[model samples]
Target: MSKFNYVLNFSPDTWTPSMESKAEENCLGGIQNFPFAPSMKIDRLGAVCDFSYTSYSRGRDPKSSQPDNQDFHLVDSRPFPKTKVRYVQRKFQKETAQAYHQKQQQQEKAEMLLRQGKKNAKMRQAGTQQYQYSRHRFVSRMRTLTEWSIEPLSSWISVAEIPLSSLPKQFLDVSKSTIEDIGWFGTLKSYNKSMDRISPKLPMALKDFGNMEFLQPTTSDDEILRDALLQPEKNIDVAITDQILACLVAAAQSKYSWHILVTNVDGKLIFDKQDGSIIDLITVNETSAEPPLPDNVNKNNRPHLLGLEALKSNQNYTQNIQINGDEGIIKQFEPIPFSEEHQDANVESKCYRYRIFSLPPRAGASSSENAQKTVRVAIRTEIDAQIPNAESENSGFIFARALNEYDPKTVKTWNTQLESQKGALLATEIRNNACQLTKWATQALLSSCDILKLGYIVRRTPNDRESHQIISVQSYKTKELSAQMGLKEENAWGIVRALVDLLSEQPEGQYVILRTPVKHVLRVYRIPDEESSELPQDEQSHKE
Candidate 1:
């Protein structure tokens, strides 16, 4: 027992005459050993069986000096002490350690037998090997599943019970996540971690806690284990499996951590966990971002047909959407929105302004004045490549041209189509939608790792005069700042000037990880917050 249990002595009259003497009779008798110690007796099963109690037949009046301090009275001294408990626990743990050792021995023996290679023992060896392999794999999987630092963490039970008898049969494949499924996740995890916290305020007496040292009888722990929980064999379930697989894919594809948007068939972002700094506004499968969809695999989930082999659901939805008005919806690109938190966590501005270039326009009223309209629309950030700009004579400009020049009616119409069936349609239907051509064209300059090989950093050094001029101005900040300073942009001379200025003017003992478009996410973890006016913590005055 983790704590002691005994009847309290209330008022004097509360104790019946017969109960007075009998209080001590059965009170400590149930306790097998009086002062349970390591050398104390234990059953053959290696369990410490002992209990102690101060029984009182009735309550005592608080004001009364003392009626009689005879049979069954509470003592003030701390009854359970270290020497006794440490000994008992040592014995119990010894047995547990022995069992663990034996299992290890058996596993190694099986391994040796496997290596010998005998005809008669072949089948046995094979079985042994499989068992060993499976156990090893299971342990590895659990480590990954829980993200636990210790390999034996799963085995480190708090000894809640001996025989988990109350477990249901249907609960064999049951796992930690399933137990969490019994309620919300994280709740049960914290609850079980609090074992002995329940108390007198608990409206009832509880587990062993007093200094009345004795090994906890296995039964109490058995009760705790049986009543407290079900046997959890694993944590990964179908949904968790999907998430883990997705993480592996994302990790492979991304240079920096990105946020994940989990949605159901409706495509609304439901679960959001951002890794690095990236505030990604979430939208469900290009539809209305609102009430989340219910999770039902069979009926509604329009599984994303990711990476060919995945989600090969040969259902009727694909064929159905092709002939229906939903053809364009099936082919749209679903960009995951990231909602990352950080002052400057590599956030790409969503509203990138694009300038229309039309023959620099004729200088007359006949000319369409707004023809070179600067349309500033919010677009999703490019996950793979920096979309070239026309000014660059490379990618961003060309990409912008295609996007701005697209048929407004088609774009607006298809956008409407996405919103209409936001939740009801299948994922396949959305993919094969009529906009497949538009989607492909947009992503063409992106990571067309499969087609157009047009995305990577290209470095070119400047010529003599250009390099000399830029280097001379070398020092400060943004290109805009350099231009304002009237420095030549011929060869990054302004950039050099900006850097030199920043080095001299910037405060000491500060670090910065600044990045702009065309640069990867820069994670700058400041070692100190110099801007804060708070005095040093160590300088606080201490009361004498």
Candidate 2:
């Protein structure tokens, strides 16, 4: 057997051995041929001693001095030598107590205010209560309109003109123009053919009713405005533009679920409509007492199809008249790139006129420093055709639109009713096509167009859907037409200003002002950057 020399130190004050070393030694002794050496090395290890004890008498023991029975009491005691954990616990308790007391005080104060017949005070207190519990998802309340005194700027200054070169070169005027002579406007034929080409799977019967093609702006208004503002020579800072303003103005009357995308880029608010948004589609009988049925159920009476037909008719009518009219009266702009199919044209009739209007600050904000910063807005308005005599100051331009009747049997004949019961017909139309007429009036007012010409066209026969004949053309002053439609320009402007101010309060980010379905309420939602692309897709799905 091999003997191993081991030095062991057993000093309680200074000596300690790790558990790993102890385990290794134990394993070595068990596996190998090592025997324990019992040597009296007092200096290397430690000295051991034994104690001698003396016995004590039971009568004189320490326990005999105390009482046989003892009483105990529980007492709350503070921790000694305060640590970070104890300090934090005390701070939290103090804050909780303070908050409880403050809430109690506010409740008592609110009750007192309510009992004192101070209505305004109660309202303010209620607002405060709501504010404390409000979350980010809670929509801000719209401002109450106590007075409708909004007015447009004394004069509007022309900003810039977007050319109409891209528009098909054709005369587009309906004044003194008959539909029979024009032969259904060749544009509709091409538009319908393109629709058919895209939807090869659609049934042939569906093609005759015209596919429900909701015409939307090729480029979003937001993108157009952004690009327009980028021009070095055109430096304009506007809180809101016409597209958003128009939506806001007509919000109270809108029945559809539409949303406006608002992006605050570098402190500038850009209002945009999503791609294929239904908001751009001209609605037919949307606000009527007996509105048209859904497109899926009624093929011919579909609002979208009717609106598209009317839109195409108006476009064709305006282009033809402008093309055939005097060349000197036509307003021309720098030509833009045109499609090969529409390259052969006499002149372009469509032109965009940009103007700026200064909106007054909020009512109560007159005393604030921000009152000096009046809200200025820019609008891109369109002109369908110039007045026959452009030199006349009374009427320099006119806005024209056509209202088509698919079946005169359902309603009164336009030719007879328009002359005898014109007022009744107008009233009926107001009830049925409230949204369409409102939009037309809004557009005309935005452009300050002199005249609004409405053409009444009906199909040649009840069975014939393609061929239509114009019965009569009625023209009204823009302001008079707005009044007839019960549109309060002042109130519209007020709504626009209020919405602009409300949106301006939000931080720099993207927000959506969604008109809730089945409710007249508009809710605001913030969109995360990652999910921003999904908004347009969502809108498209809704459209489909």
Candidate 3:
């Protein structure tokens, strides 16, 4: 049999009586026994057994093999001196570098403060107020008006001061009385009288008034005005100049695009070009004033129909004037007394005023260029969404008329425009184009009675060329299904499979793939069609 059965294990006890004698005998045996001693018989098996017993029994189980000494002993001393010296040198260098950087920071801060002080001094000297040239110019023009007319009640109506350059030499030499009291239609009448004044014809149209207070100005307006002013060689008609100025003023009031509409004085629509999708553009005259309907005629009434004016005679009713023979109870109607004081109270003045004029783009105009140019003057600026405060008035403006360094020469058309076309696919163009198969798949996926939902798997693979695939029409084995579902069948794979099948059946287009794992929904993006996958992101995305 085995010698292992003869071995005996004992509990760990250093105080066993036989151990002290055995240890002394073993020490003596180790010292006395030599390989040359013929008198000493060596039993290898017995010696091995004795060694095993000594190692296993009465072993030091209560004690650990850790060093007992706490004091440090210098075993290797050469590297310590060099390491200590290097550490001291590094500490000194770090302190020097920190001090130098601190000095530099202090110097920079002092210079910045000095520059700020100089800027403050200059601002104080310049009176800290921006020059408002618009109000000044308006006031100067008003002061230059030498001609005035008296109304029925002696109220003064200022005759518009027409620049001599705007009219022909014949009109300048003609009597000023011909231009007087042309009524609210004075501007149009003047333009008609000086028909040959235009060197380059301008399209006349009704102004579409936009928000005036919050308009962001563009660089094109500035350039146009500057070119008109500085370059006298340019054939800019007075009408064109006036129209441009009106458009600029309207743009300065709002960032929205206003359509150019040509209409008559009686508010008849002639020509209109759509500006934007927002339908709030209000048609006004060249002076930017909306036309008001006459009190007798409703604006909605047909222009051909004329209604007779109703009689204004008042009927008085008094209970005191009633006859004594009257049987029915007569209701007394008394007029409330009007107070002169209340009627004489002055109303508050308006903060802003608008003027209206007929645009140059009349229906009978000879040239279509003026109308086209006016219609093409589309300008819009992005409204700043920053929190409003006393400061931060610098709003950003984007002028589509000018090209930037980074902007493409040809603006890339949006995919949405193509997608909006009938039967246009945004992603992959159909290859097989089988309508029946797709229809059947869509019907099968939508059907609630289908029991083989776990057959399909929508999975993403490592291959970039074919990263995503939906393996439909293949059922999962019982073991695999149990493993995937953590041994509980909740019909999760079935639902995913149905969704995948439905999406795959649709004509190549944008599709949303959603997954509900725990409580919240997760999005798993499948690869789109090969062609659309390479299209650049939206301009807004690039900006962000």
Candidate 4:
């Protein structure tokens, strides 16, 4: 018998066996008997082990070196157009079948729900019409109810109980005729004419109350309404009262279909109507007990509001403090440090301070005597991480020598001076007021400069949040001017900041072009121009 044994070593080391003579008797004659020593052919397994997948068949073209049927198919098979997986056949159509079933079920459910909704809608409409009719009848009986001397039901009467058969034993009483005089304002012929008359009177009233330019030229009745809703405490002024009445009167007389909304001084008696048929009444009764004080009343309820006494007491008259770029002097403002009872490990705490410069004389002071007199009020500022620009280090706090000297950059000192119940209330007020003033000033500035085009710039902060910036320039010249200013067209935020700084620092009466992502061209106007009287430079700086 003949046998072959082989050993393979993949290692790098090579060792040679010592020279030894084979025993003549033991030596096999198998190799001598074979003519070519078995031809030394490599089998399929051996070829695979060597990583050679090529075929050795000679029947195919010699030039075609492909190994397997796959390679031949790839090289010579007819091309087929690509198709989506859904179009192709699969063993299990689980997803496709499930999607079809879900869609059918959704359509059926939607149809049923829509039918039910239509039925409910019809019922609701019928009920609404019935209620409105009954309400009209009940209101018409107001004259009869008053003549019978029956006490009026509270305004909280449920609509369900408003019967058409007979008037309720009790009905809301009407007060003295305020609406009778409302029509006496003598209706104007056109809305534009009424607006023209009321618009001029609004500013005059504001000025008469020593509030210079408090109301913008385009101040809308809606804005006044919104302010009354949001800042009730701040609305307790003669100017605001007159402004509201004037706006309401003008709107009522206008040709437009404006409905009247009546509410008491306390807003408890509130009602609205379209026809102006009912006269809602507000009155005080001697027999009724005084309204109870609000359960939540506190001394600092409206710390931002300045009553006549407070305003008179803190009446400050000073000159504008030139902005000193000296950090050494500015840093001398050591206001009381901020403190928190429960500080969080994850929350970052940042402190800021704002100085309100050139507060036009208290709302009712004569501007003639105090034309040059200005007052600076400083308040502590805090930025929560939640706001987009809270992390920004640029606090934009302006400083002047004539400002109230009680610690300009300190939160605690300002809180003490303002007699704030909570340290944070005044800060909120300052931010709100600043945003309001900025909105008005921007509109006025754009109008005064006769520029209709403006650009809005925005950028993402480190936290991946966006902040907005306004950039004004001459129309359609952003690209050309951007090149002149050496600004990158893509770096929108940087351009806006640089341009704002440049324009603010420039001398008055000079025009500059600023580029933004917006397409509108804006004419740049500084606050100190002829329109300076409309918005003070100090207020403008605070807004900026």
Top TM-score prediction, candidate number: 2
Which digits, one per residue and each the tens of the lDDT, describe model 1 over residues 1-544? 5444675434465322333455555555556665664342313212212123232222244533354434557768866655746888889999999999999999999988777757546657677777788789777644322221111222222211111111111111111111121111100000011212321122111111122211111211222222222223421111211122122222211222232222221111112222212211111122212211222232221111110111111111111111222222212222212212222342221111111111121112123323222111111112111222223412221111000001112333323423354233223222332122123222221211112211100011211111100000011122332233222222121121122222223233322222212123222212244422221221101101
TM-score of 1: 0.16
True-structure lDDT of candidate 1? 0.24
Give the per-residue lDDT of model 2 (tens digit) for 1-544.
6555554534455444343345545434544344566443435322222122233345467775456534545676976675757888999999999999999999999998778768666656787666555632243211111111111122322222212221112121223211111001011100011211211122122112132222234324334455545654544344344445666666767665566777766645667766545565556666766565443344655655665566666555444334333333444443322222345643343555556565555444435333435555556665666554456642456677767664466655666676588788888787777666777788887776787767666665565546665556666788998888777765666555555555566566677776655445666666666656554443322421
The better-scoring model by lDDT among 3 and 4 is: 4
Which stretches in model 2 have alpha-carbon errors above 4 Å? Answer: 1-224, 231-235, 239-244, 295-297, 320-329, 336-348, 364-372, 390-394, 461-466, 536-544
lDDT of 3 by residue, 107-135 (tens): 99999999999987876676534334545
- Candidate 1: give its CA RMSD in angstroms: 35.9
State TM-scores per candidate. 0.16, 0.54, 0.14, 0.17
Alpha-carbon deviation at 316 in model 2, angstroms? 2.4
- The per-model lDDT (C-alpha) reads 0.24, 0.53, 0.24, 0.25
Which regions of candidate 3 deviate over 4 angstroms? 1-85, 128-544
- Candidates sorted by TM-score, best first: 2, 4, 1, 3
lDDT of 4 by residue, 310-375 (tens): 221111100001111232122232221221222332111121322111122222223343222332
